[model samples]
Target: MLLPQPRESIQDNQKGKVFFVALFTVCFFIMHYGIFVFVQTSMFFAVSSIYRGDLFNLSIPALK
Candidate 1:
């Protein structure tokens, strides 16, 4: 009976560790994806503004 108790406790500890590791991995992936999307959107807007000639006047003034 006592032998079974230690085995059960060890299994529970392992399960808990696995659960936390998986949770952290999922959160990390979500955060990385969010940052990637934000950067892509910002770059798209910057490129579009430049393409529309909106940034030309701004650049000329900066060069002066």
Candidate 2:
């Protein structure tokens, strides 16, 4: 037979589980946001670089 757990202990256990789940969810969102920002900035930089390259080629006809 299983031993009976105290009500207070069971409540505390449930609270801890909830806290852990909340912490995990917050961390996951933060990590996801960071990755999204990184991708956006990287893409912006890539596009800007390509644009600059085109401008540079256009400005100096001797380079062509």
Candidate 3:
């Protein structure tokens, strides 16, 4: 018969799982939000430049 594992070890394993899940969720949200913001900003700049008749001069604000 297989012996049961200790309770402390089981609890620690569960805690580790929870920590990794929380960390993954936070990282995913940050990456998604960052990508969204980047796309939106780029599109806004592109449109604005086109509207102002300077499409060729379109550049990131930070590069100015």
Off by over 4 Å in 2: 1-10, 50-64
Model 2 C-alpha lDDT per residue in residues 1-64, reported as the tens digit of each score: 5786566667755878867988999999999999999888767856765333443353433444
lDDT of 1 by residue, 1-64 (tens): 5343344456765888767988999999999999999888668867665343343344433344
Rank the candidate models, highest TM-score first. 3, 1, 2
The better-scoring model by lDDT among 1 and 3 is 3
Q: Which digits, one per residue and each the tens of the lDDT, describe model 3 over residues 1-64?
A: 5685566667755878867988999999999999999888768876766343344655455555
Cα error, candidate 2, residue 56 (Å) = 24
TM-score of each: 0.60, 0.59, 0.60
| Local distance difference test values of all predictions, in order | 0.68, 0.70, 0.73
Q: What lDDT is obtained when candidate 2 is compared to the true structure?
A: 0.70
For candidate 3, what is the total of clashing residue pairs? 0
Prediction RMSDs, each to the true structure: 9.7, 10.2, 8.5
TM-score of candidate 1 versus the correct structure, residues matched by position: 0.60
Off by over 4 Å in 1: 1-10, 50-64
lDDT of 1 at 36: 100
Q: How much is 57 displaced in model 1, in angstroms?
A: 19
